[model samples]
Target: MVEESAENVVPPTKGGGKKPKSAAAAAAEPVATSEAGNSPATESKVPPKKEKPPAVEAKPFTEFIQQDYLPALTQALADKGVSDLQLNLERAKIAIKGFETAPECSQVIGRWNGGNRQFNVYFFDDNIQGQRAISCVDLGHRASTLEAFVIDERKVTLDLLVAGVVLRLNSQKWLTRN
Candidate 1:
């Protein structure tokens, strides 16, 4: 062996100049020293987590009708000897009593009977007698009987009632003008 150099004989650095322990070993070491120079309890204490609230759901009008009004109307029609009744809320019209009429007004009427149907009823005003004269059972019926009138005029309200009771009665809100 050659003569050792002064640089090679240098003393160790701080902490005895020995290589520091690895991350894993250091982490496993004690956070606090005991009275006797030993590690304290190593268990961690974590607080419990909070729970979240539930979400609310909103329903569409058509869904409300299907769930509520449709069933009730089906039953009511069955009780009234009406083998079938088609309601068009989109057009606000009712096709019943072998005829169809707009619930809004008497100006336009759609008639359906057996296989022959016509929509030829018109009125200058709400006055029932002023409408185009048609058979009470045909396309040109003038005065709509009380029952017929109510069916046309109140169909929407009836549908609403059915929907409200069966679906979410307190959930629906609307405004009507006569």
Candidate 2:
């Protein structure tokens, strides 16, 4: 009779139809002896840790427009050969004749070339994440107005806001020198 090795020995199954564990699987498994039989303890698996999202910059719209946007826009326009560009922040209604006199307007007007070239950005609300209407009169001619929303959804940072306005103006050739 041939001798059987301990590694090749198969554990008896209750139903007598279960497949025996292989040598590698039996060697890898932990041996536990209970009162009546051998049983493995339940595995406790720890879940993977989740990564956090980046923080957004929360700046007040009016403050950002006044303190950050205006200066950056001025420099950007000046760099684009707009030397006479003038920027004004006012609270009044949007009108050609009485916009400067209106008390409820939330707008910033940029005028260059002796008031002949002008564009006004009218804020619908105090939040940059909302809407803004831009009306431009290029060389005494009214161009089609467009609405702008928050360019970056993640944050309302100064650079993103300024870049949005500057890019819009640049794309429309609104601030280009003639």
Candidate 3:
């Protein structure tokens, strides 16, 4: 597993954080006992095996993004003309479409740590006037404007994060940031 520091450790989900149970643990039907003249030669006792998720250590960030977050968030961001965003599965880095020409301070910012499997996203809007500047970061954007802050929950799923990000981007407050 990637080495996770406390700074990027997302809180664990409130429930159902463990892996799926093996089929034997999930079987619900009653089986015949020896008293019922059950013949070992004619009886089947094996249960179907449960599939396990690949180990995180194999590809820490890639698996999570490919299997969980991307599927849920891709369509939504595409609908907003922000498609083409790519998560560097190897790291917490990202590339947002249409940010190349924008001032560095006005571009979207994303950072993450694979070990802790947590990330933060920020979008800044700024206007420069005759050597003066005003920006969302300077104005003190609200807590909800942050993807990480909005995604805080005991049980955070990719779908939940997608919804939160979409909502924040579409809000009037965000639109008027500059």
Q: Compared with the true structure, what per-residue lDDT tens digits does model 2 show for residues 1-178?
A: 9899996777787886787888788899978856645343422233456996643335466676777779988987787777998898887666654344644547888898898878787776766666666776777775455455454466466666666667667766765534
Q: Which is the better candidate, 2 or 3, if ranked by lDDT?
A: 2
CA RMSD per model (angstroms)? 18.7, 10.1, 24.4
lDDT of 1 by residue, 1-178 (tens): 7887884454556885686565777899868865755455432333456886631112344454445545665565345343434432232233335356545433333222342323222222333222222212333444343221222332235444333222221121111122
Q: What lDDT, from 0 to 1, does candidate 1 have?
A: 0.38
Worst 10 residues of 3 by lDDT: 127-136
Worst 10 residues of 1 by lDDT: 168-177
Query: How far off is residue 84 in model 3, in Å?
Result: 5.6
TM-scores, one per candidate: 0.24, 0.54, 0.33
> What residue runs in model 3 are displaced by over 4 Å at the alpha carbon?
1-32, 35-59, 81-148, 172-178
List the candidate 2 regions with Cα displacement exceeding 4 Å: 1-57, 96-105, 141-146, 149-154, 176-178
For model 3, residues 53-101, the per-residue Cα lDDT tens digits are 8543234433555666565565766676653444432321123344346
